[model samples]
Target chain A: GQQVMQIPQYQHVQEGEDFTTYCNSSTTLSNIQWYKQRPGGHPVFLIQLVKSGEVKKQKRLTFQFGEAKKNSSLHITATQTTDVGTYFCAGPPHRFNKFYFGSGTKLNVKP
Target chain B: EAGVAQSPRYKIIEKRQSVAFWCNPISGHATLYWYQQILGQGPKLLIQFQNNGVVDDSQLPKDRFSAERLKGVDSTLKIQPAKLEDSAVYLCASRRVRRDGNYNEQFFGPGTRLTVL
Candidate 1:
C-alpha cells in the first residue's frame, strides 16, 4: 500500500524558465526524500537519496535517484522569484518506517 | 535546536465542533508525526509515534480521530465530531534516531490551520 506519485500537478515558471518534477513509487524504496513548501510554509527538508542511481546537487537544485529505487527527480535551474513553493516526494517501504507522500509539485516562480 | 511545536496557528470550527491540537517534539527526538495537509495534497500520514508507543495508526480517523503521546513527550490530536472534510493543515513532525538504525530529517511544525465551517 505504499504510494508516492508526483507529476506536474501545477507549475508556472517564468523568471528564467526551467523546472522539473517527477516522482514515482508503488513499492521499492529504501530512501528518498525532498520537500519544500514555502507559500504558507511548513514542509522543509530538502534532500536525501540513497545510492541506487543517486545524483544530488543543491545550488541550482537537481536531484535524481532511480535505478529501480522506484523513481525520483527534481530540477530547477534559472527559475527564481524565490522559486515559489510545493514540491514533495517522500518514501519508505522496503524495510518500512512509514512514509509515503508525493502529490505535490506546485512551483510558480513568475517575475 | 527547537523546531517542531504546533498549536493553534489557526482554526475555525463549525460543523460539529470539537478540536484539539498540540505537539512538542525535538528534544532528543524519538520519531513523532501526524499530518493531514489537504489543500493541494501531500503530507498525509495520520499518526505515528515511537516513544510513547503507537508506531502507526493506519491513517487514523478512528471514528473521528484521536491521538496521544503521554510520557515519552508531549502530543495530542483530537477531532471528535468535526466534519466539513475536517478542513486541512495539521502538520507536526520530528525525527532523529540514527545510531545506524537510520531515519532522520523531518522537523516540521508551524501547522494547525483547520477551518471546518
Candidate 2:
C-alpha cells in the first residue's frame, strides 16, 4: 500500500509570515495534488504537480515536485488570515486507481 | 454549474445504531469518491466509484461499512452497528472525466458530520 508522510503536523505563523508543508510518499506517484480544508468546511482542490522537478505558482502560493516524483512541497509567501487551513497532499500510485492522502498540515495564522 | 450535493449535513446517533448518508455528484462526472475525515486529520479514502461500478474500496471496513452507487448517479454510504470511533465527517467528491488521464481536480460537497455516542 502507498502512503504519504507530511511534516509539521501543525503550523502557526504571524499574518505576514511564510509557511510551508512537505510531503513524501513511500512509492513513486504519477502525479500529486494539493487540497485545502477550512475549519468546518469540506476539502477543496488547490493544485496538482506532475513531471519531475516541476514548479507551479498561484498568486502567493508555490508548489514544487521533487525530481524523484516521490516528494512535494507547498509554500505560501506572506501568508494572510485567509490562508489559515489544513493543507493536504495526495496522489495515486503508479498503475493504481485509488488515491492516497497525506496526514495533512494544519496552518493557523494570527492576524 | 451545480457542485456535489449531500444530505443531512449533520447526524447524531447512539452506538450500535445504523446510519446512512447520501451523495449526488456533479452532472456528467464519471468519478465519485467518499472520504472520512476525523477531527484534526486529513481525509481518508473510503470508497471510489467509476460510474456505477466500484473502482476501489480497499480502506473501507467491510464488517460495518458499505456503499452503493445505483444508476451511476446517486450514491449512499451506510454504517451498521456504528461505534463511537465512527464519529467523523464524511465527504463526497466528484471529478469530470479527462481525456488526458489526469484526475487532479475534484469538487467536494459539504460533508456530513457524524457523532456517535
Candidate 3:
C-alpha cells in the first residue's frame, strides 16, 4: 500500500521562531499539495507543487518538492500565533483526483 | 462562491447504531470526495465520486459503509452497525475537473464529528 508519512508529529515553537515539517511518500507522485487546518476547523488548501524539485513561497511560508517527487517540505519563518494548526501533505498515486494524505504535523505557536 | 456543505456538525451514538452523513459540494464542481479524520490525524480518503460515478472506494469498508450521489451533486455516506473505531470527523471536499490532467485544489467543508461510544 502506498503511504505518505510526515515527521515531527507535534511541534511547539516560540512566536518568533521558525518551524518545518517534512513529508515523504512511499511511491513517486505526479503532484503534491499542502493544506492547513486550524484547530477545530476544516482543512484549507494552501499550495500545490507539480514540477519535480519545485519550490514555491507564500509570504513567510516556503514549500519545496524533492527532485524525485518522493518528498516535500513546508517551512514557516517567524511563526505567529495564527500559525498554530496542523499541516498535511497530500499526493496522488500516479493519477489525479484521488489523494493519499500524510499523518500531518501539528504546530503549536507560543507567544 | 459557496463552499462545500455538510449537515449535523456533530453526532453521538452508541456502538452498533447506524449513522448517515450528508454533503453538498460546491456548485459546478464535478469531483467530490469523502474522508475520515481521526483526532490528531490527517484526513483519509473513504470514497471519491466523479460526478454520479464512483472513481474509487478501495479504502471504504464495503460491508459497513456505503455512499451515493444520485444527481452528481449532493452526496450521502451511511454506516450501519457502527463500531467504536468509527468515531472520527467526516470531511467532504470538492474540486473542478480539468481536462488537462492538472491537479486542482480541493475545497473542504466543515466536517461532521462523530463520537461512537
Candidate 4:
C-alpha cells in the first residue's frame, strides 16, 4: 500500500511570516496533488504537479515536486489570516485507483 | 455548474444503531470516491468507483461498512451496528474523465459529519 508522510503536523505563524510543509511518499507516483480544507469544510483542490522537479505558483504560494517524483513541498510566502486551513498532498500508489493522502499540515495564521 | 452533492449535512446516532449517507456526483463525471476524516486528521479513502463498477475498496471494512454506486450516478454508504469510533466527516468527491490519465483534480462536497455516541 502507498502512503504519504507530512512534516510539522501543525503550524502556526504570525501574519506576514512564511510557512512550509513537506510531503514524501513511500513509492514513486505518477503525479502529486495538493488540497486545502478549512475547519469543518471539505477539501478543495489546490494544484497538481506532474513532471519531475516541477514547480508551480499561485500568488504567494509555491508548490514543488521532487526530482524523484516521490516527494513534494508547499511553501507559502508572507502568510495571511486567510491561509488558515489544513494542507494535504495526494497521489495514486499504483493503478489501483485509490489516492493516498498525507497526514496533512494544519496551518493557523495569526494576525 | 453544480458541484458534488451530499445529503444530511450532519448526523448524530447512538452506538449499535444503523446509519446511511448519500452522494450525488457532478453530472457527466465518471469517477466517484468516498473518504472519512477524523478530527485533526486528513481524509482517508474508503472507496472508489468508475461508473457502476468499483475500482478499489481495499480500505473499506466489509464487516460493518458497505457502499454501492447504482447506475453510476448516485452512491450510498451504510453502516450497521455502528461503533462510537465511526464518528467522522464523510466526504464525497468526483472527477471528470481525463484522457491524459491524470485524475488529481477532484471536487469534494460539503461532507456529512457524523457523530456516534
Chain A TM-scores, per candidate, are 0.34, 0.98, 0.97, 0.96
Clashes of each: 0, 0, 0, 0
TM-score (all chains, Cα) for each model: 0.35, 0.98, 0.98, 0.98
**Local accuracy by lDDT, each model:** 0.90, 0.94, 0.95, 0.93
Clashing pairs in 2: none
Candidate 3, residues B11-105, lDDT tens digits: the string is 99999999999999999999999999999889999999999999999999999999999999999999998999999999999999989978789
Question: Which stretches of model 1 miss by more than 4 angstroms?
Answer: A1-14, A17-53, A56-61, A65-73, A80-85, A102-108, B1-13, B17-35, B38-41, B46-57, B65-80, B83-85, B89-115
Q: What clash pairs does model 1 have?
A: none
lDDT of 3 by residue, A5-107 (tens): 9999999999999999999999999899999999999999999999999999999999999999999999999999999999999979676546899999999
Fnat for the candidates in order: 0.78, 0.94, 0.91, 0.97
User: Could you tell me the TM-score of chain B in model 2?
Assistant: 0.98
Clashing pairs in 4: none
lDDT of 1 by residue, A1-111 (tens): 677889989989899999999999988888899989998888899988987899999999999999999998999999999879999989787897788889999999889
**Which pairs clash inside model 3?**
none
Tell me the spans in candidate 2 whose CA falls farther than 4 Å from its real position. Answer: none
Residues B6-76, candidate 1, lDDT per residue (tens digit)? 89889899989899999999898888999999898998999999889999899898999999999878899
Please provide, for model 4 over A15-46, each residue's C-alpha lDDT reduced to its tens digit, 9 standing for 90 to 100: 99999999999998888999999987889999
Candidate 1 CAPRI-style tier: acceptable
